[model samples]
Target: MTAHYFIGIKVEKSIRTKLTEWQNVLAKSMNYKDWTSEEDFHITLKFLGGCSDKTIDVYKNKLMNEEWPGAFRIAIGPAGYFGNPKQPRVFYADAEKPKELEVIKLEVEKIGSELGFQTEGRTYRPHVTLAKKNAEGMSPLALESYDLLLDESYSMLIDHFSIFRIHPQQNPKYEAIAHISLNKEE
Candidate 1:
């Protein structure tokens, strides 16, 4: 079987629990084909469709040796959707764009391209996916704007990213194959 991979920021357990609760509430307002499992919540950096183990090894080694921007805090923004609001294709919590995040993303793109990985055509929009697609013949929602789930200002600390392999038959479909820490202190 082919190994499908992506680079992403892992969501902490506490944040996952919180997001899952918020997703539960959102479910009452709108319906979706798939609600993201808490374990699967993440902000994708790049989606690398398929690769050979040898290629994956080379990519992983390069990442380990590459310089990354130091850890920074990324705020969780309000709820947002792609496609129509009432009948959305995807629903997610946005992550504030920090230059540090951009640096890492761009670096990943550069390195990936060097390794013959296809570059993403769309501009990167960091987010933790909540749900996707309208459920089978689901009714359209009013789609009132939803605010950040956390009270006051909230942000997640970023110190690392990883290459995760997809396991479609699993609860947590994405499994981290390699973790690349970003200026992690001892």
Candidate 2:
């Protein structure tokens, strides 16, 4: 079977729990499909379309060898709706440091290209999607606006990175096919 793949930041359990709680509340205020499970939630760094097993292995090696600059603190905020708010589509928590995040994003895209995967050339904006539209009507909400406060801030210690393959099925599963753990003093 063909697999859909992407690169993402695997959040620690502690951070995941906190983000989930906040997401639950925000999801309730919007009309959207609930996430399959908390485990399925992740911040995608790159979308690496489809690839053969050989290609995946080659990219996995590259990712394992690439060094992270250091730990970066992501201050997430600026809640807003995407598409048309009336017939609302996506609700997201915007990433504050677009330039900094783009640096990493570009590197990941480069790796994906090296692996013989299609890399998108579109402008990137880092955001955690809170919700997506469903059959339900738009849930009216007063989206909170702020000067990029830390709705949930954490230092993403870049010791490791992973590549996951997404299954094609209802409530699809994501399998981590490869990872590179950084040797940093924790």
State, as a TM-score between 0 and 1, how close model 1 is to the true structure.
0.90
Among all candidates shown, the one with the greatest lDDT: 1
Model 2 agreement with the true structure over 36-135: per-residue lDDT tens digits: 3456655678877776777777887787787754455565454556787654577665655544456667888887776666778666767666567654
Quality of model 2 by C-alpha lDDT? 0.63
Q: How many backbone clashes does candidate 2 have?
A: 1
- Per-residue lDDT tens digits for candidate 1, residues 1-186, read 888999999988877877787777677677787889899999999999888889889989999999888888888656666877666788777788889999999999999999999899998899888889767432223334443352322478999999999998889899999999998654
lDDT score, residue 39, model 2? 64
Off by over 4 Å in 2: 34-36, 98-100, 139-156, 170-172, 182-186
Taking the candidates one at a time, how many backbone clashes does each contain? 0, 1
Off by over 4 Å in 1: 136-153
> Which residue pairs of candidate 1 clash?
none
Q: Tell me the TM-score of each prediction against the true structure.
A: 0.90, 0.76
